[model samples]
Target: MMHSFGELVTKFTSYFNVRHFPMAPSTLYDPCEYFLGLGGKRIRPVMCLMGNELFDKITPDAYHVANAIELFHNFTLIHDDIMDKAPLRRGMQTVHTKFDEPTALLSGDVMMIQAYEYINKVRTNTIHRILTLFNKTAAQVCEGQQLDMDFEKKETVDLDDYIEMIGLKTSVLMAASLQLGAILGGAGDSNAKHLYEFGLNLGIAFQVQDDYLDAFGDPEKFGKQVGGDIVANKKTFLLIHALDVATGAQKEELQNLLKQNEDDKVEKVLAIYRSCGVDEWARSLKEKYVTVAFQHLEDIAVLSVRKKPLKELTSFLVQRDF
Candidate 1:
C-alpha cells in the first residue's frame, strides 16, 4: 500500500539518520552530519520516494536515489549559504558560519561526491539514464546560480529571465528527482516525463511562494527576516515587477531604496511594492503555476487514489505560509 506524505517523510528520515558515513576525518564529516541533522522538510527525497511508489513498492533503489537527492540538496545549500553570506538555515547556523568557510566548502564538495556514490547504488538497467538526467540537472543548477549572482549586479532583469533562472536553478532538480524515482520504479517513459513536468511546475510555484513570503509573511512564522530579499537587493519577483511598472518619482524612490542601508529600508521598499500591486501579481502567478502543476499531475496515467498523496503534498506546499 502507498504511504501518506507524513509516513513517507518519517520513513525517509529514519533511514537517513542511520546511514553510515566515514569517521576518519572528524572535521569534514562532522559538518555534513550537523548540516543534515538540522532537519529540513526533506521534500525532494520524499517526492522521490512518492514517485517510486506510484508504480511499485518503495525499493532499496528508491532509498538510494532519495539519499543522493537529499545529499545533493544539502550540498547546494552549504555552498549557496556561503555565496549569499547567509548566517542561518533552519534556525541554526549555516555550515560556513558554524564552521569555517574553507571547511564548509570542502565538506560541500565531498557531499556532492557522496551523492554520486548513492546514485551508483541504484542497481538498475537505467542507471546510465538516471546519471545522465542527474548530471544535466546538476549543471543547470550551477548555471542558474551563476545567473542569479549576475542578476544582483545588473541594473535591470527581465521577469522572463528571472523565471528561467529559478527554473534552472531550483525546479530542474525537483523534476529530476521525480523522473529518477519513476525510472527506478519501472515506470514508462511517458509517465516519467509527466511526473517530471509535475515536479517542475510545483518547484516554480514553491519558489514564487518563497518570493511572496519574503515580503509579506509574518516574521514569527517566516523563520527569517521578513524583508531579507529587499534588504539584500535580491532581484525577487516583487522587486522586478515594481521596477518594470513604477514610473517617475515612484521609480526614483525604488532605485534610491535599493542603494540605502538604513533600518527602515525593508519597510520603504515594501511600501513601494504595495503601491505597484506586485504582491497581487505574485499571488496570481503563484496560483497559475500551482494550477499548471495539478494539470501535469492529472495527466499521469494512474488511479486517482494513487495520486492522492501527491495532491495532498502539493496542497500543503502551495498553501504553506512559511
Candidate 2:
C-alpha cells in the first residue's frame, strides 16, 4: 500500500515538528526553532520521502535525510532573506528582521551544521556518495546566488543564462533531495539519476510558474506584493522575454519602467509584457518543462501506481495559482 501525498506530508510534518534542537545558547537556537516553526510547503523533504518509497518502504534513513534537507533549506532561506532585505516569510517576520542580523547569521550557520549531523545519522554504505552530492549541490547553490546578484546589476540577461542560474540555485537541491532518498532506498544508479532529472525538470517548471505568478497572480492569493519583482528590477523570465521582443517605444518604456521607483510601475511593466507576448511565451515555456518532467517520470522503470503520488505532487506544484 502506498501513501497519498497528503498522508506522506502529514506523517513527515508530525515527525519533523517533534525533532530536538539544542537548548543551550538560546539566541542562536531559538531563531532556528522559530524559523522552522513558520510552516512552508515542505515540498523538498516530502519529495525525498516519496523518492525512497518509490523503490522500497520509507525507512528511518529516509527520515533522517528528509530532516537534513529541510534544515538546509531553511538555513538558506534565513540567509537569503537577509540578503534580499525581505521583511516577511510565510506571512511572519523573517529571522533577520525578528531577531538581530548577527543572530540570524549564526542561526543559519548552526542549521547547516545540524543538517550535516542529521545526514551523518544515515546508516548506509553509500554515505560518501550522498555527502559528495550534497556538498556539490550546496556549492552550486552559492554560485547561482552570486550569479543572480550579478544579474541584478547588468542591463541585459540572456534567457539561457537565467535558466542556468535557476537550475543551480534552485533546481539542484530539489534534484539532489530526490536522488539522495532514492540512493538510500537501494535504487540503482540509473533510476536514481532518472529521479534527479524528474526533480530538476519539475523544479525548473515551478520556478517559471513562480515568475509568471509574480506578475499575473491575484495579490491576495500571492501572499506577497504582486509586481514586487518588477519593482525590484529582478530579471525574471517574463521580463527577459519582454526585453528581447519589445522594440522602439515599447523597449524605451520598459527601460524607463525598470528605472522608476513608483507605485504604478507594476501595471506599466505588465502592459509592456503583455504587448510583447511575454506572458504567452512564459506560459508555453512553463508547460514545456512540465511536459519534460512528466516524460522523465514516465521513464523511471517503476509501476504506474508507484509513480502516482509524485505525479500528483508535480501536478499540484506546476498548476498552482498562488
Q: Best candidate, TM-score-wise?
A: 2
Per-residue error at 110 for model 1, in Å? 0.9
Query: Deviation in angstroms for 56 in model 2?
Result: 0.7
TM-score of 1: 0.96
Clashes of each: 0, 0
Q: What tens-digit string does per-residue lDDT give for candidate 2 at 119-151?
A: 999897888988998899889988988998898
- What is the lDDT, from 0 to 100, of the residue 308 in candidate 1? 89
lDDT, candidate 1, 62-114, per-residue tens: 99999999999899999999999999998899999999999999999999999
RMSD value for candidate 2: 1.2
Cα-based lDDT for every prediction: 0.90, 0.90
